[model samples]
Target: MENHLYDGLIRYIIKKTRLDKGLQQRDLADLHISDGTISNVERGKVVVRDDTFNYLLNKLGLDGGKLNELVKKEKEFIEHLKFRLDCIESMLNNGYLELANEELKLIHLDEFHPLAPFLMYLKGRYIYKKKE
Candidate 1:
């Protein structure tokens, strides 16, 4: 989900700021946020609401510029991945198995990337067909 990307970016920034400021998760307790919520947010396991996000940022004494930049980078990464996936799909459709396989190798997806499962499926299909 694109929302996850945005939330993940914000969460990462918040976590980084916390570390840089030497603030522990418990330090935010006065904000009335639970430890589980803080942990989930730090791990990017959940999306934080806008108001709560702003409150967290304010508490961290961080400017929004870093968050904005991270969000922009996230969007750019998604667009680039879409382009690569389209190229791979096209190569496969044209029966250029080798070319598709080469393109798949160039994908450079992170282990926890959202498209990892789809990429795995494509890779398995490619491998299965290659050996046939």
Candidate 2:
């Protein structure tokens, strides 16, 4: 069968639920999946089966309107992160290291932050590129 288009909406729903429940990726994986599978789902590269999705939603204590709102917020956050990354990249390329650093600091303060390490690595690379 042709693969379904990867859905950021679904991915975000899972992410928010996981974070709300304080479950790490490994912890969720141990419930009946592999860590790699969870990673793929979070990245929106794979579609999970309906039964598995329902199990996750139930486990996370999400249903009805609350679940819908979680998915909506996830999409919003994902879009915001994309925009923030773009802005950070532009600032770095324009020699605005201080601004980029400030944004990175903000991200570090978020509980479910994912890109802080990657952003730091990019900052190091930016410095190196400038020296070359």
Candidate 3:
């Protein structure tokens, strides 16, 4: 599928928020919104209104500059993550499983701050895949 810039941006923000909080997708879904809505927003297919955006930020316990900063950091962070993931995959393919595993572990340990729950979901995916 063609990637939509807004979708990518939103997804990045969602992920950042989730990671900071250290909660799983289902756990986050139980607190504020549903997993489907989170996925949809991250995909950028759905348009979020200002009220909803404010709600999300507030629910995630963001206020003032931190919230603004997160929005501003979205683009750069997403690009970096994409690049890192590509590198990790390449390493795994080139017999660098140990290195890749190390990198993955770092990601797992890194706190997403307020987005911990969402980050937990991504971590779960990474761990699940590693086990497979």
* Per-model TM-score on C-alpha atoms: 0.58, 0.57, 0.43
Candidates sorted on lDDT, descending: 1, 2, 3
lDDT by residue (16-132, candidate 2, tens digit) is: 668767888787665566777777767766777766555555666766567677657766776788688778888888888777777756764233345445566666866775676
Between 2 and 3, whose lDDT is larger? 2
lDDT of 1: 0.70
lDDT of each: 0.70, 0.66, 0.59
After superposing candidate 2 on the true structure, give the runs of residues whose Cα lies further than 4 Å from its correct spot: 1-5, 23-48, 109-125, 130-132
What is the descending TM-score order? 1, 2, 3
Q: After superposition, how far is residue 45 of candidate 3 from its true place, in Å?
A: 1.8
Candidate 1 deviant stretches above 4 angstroms? 1-35, 42-62
Q: Write the per-residue lDDT of candidate 1 for residues 100-132, one digit (tens) a residue.
A: 998898777654455667788778878877887
Between prediction 2 and prediction 3, which has the larger TM-score?
Answer: 2
* Clashing residue pairs for model 1: none
Q: Candidate 2: TM-score?
A: 0.57
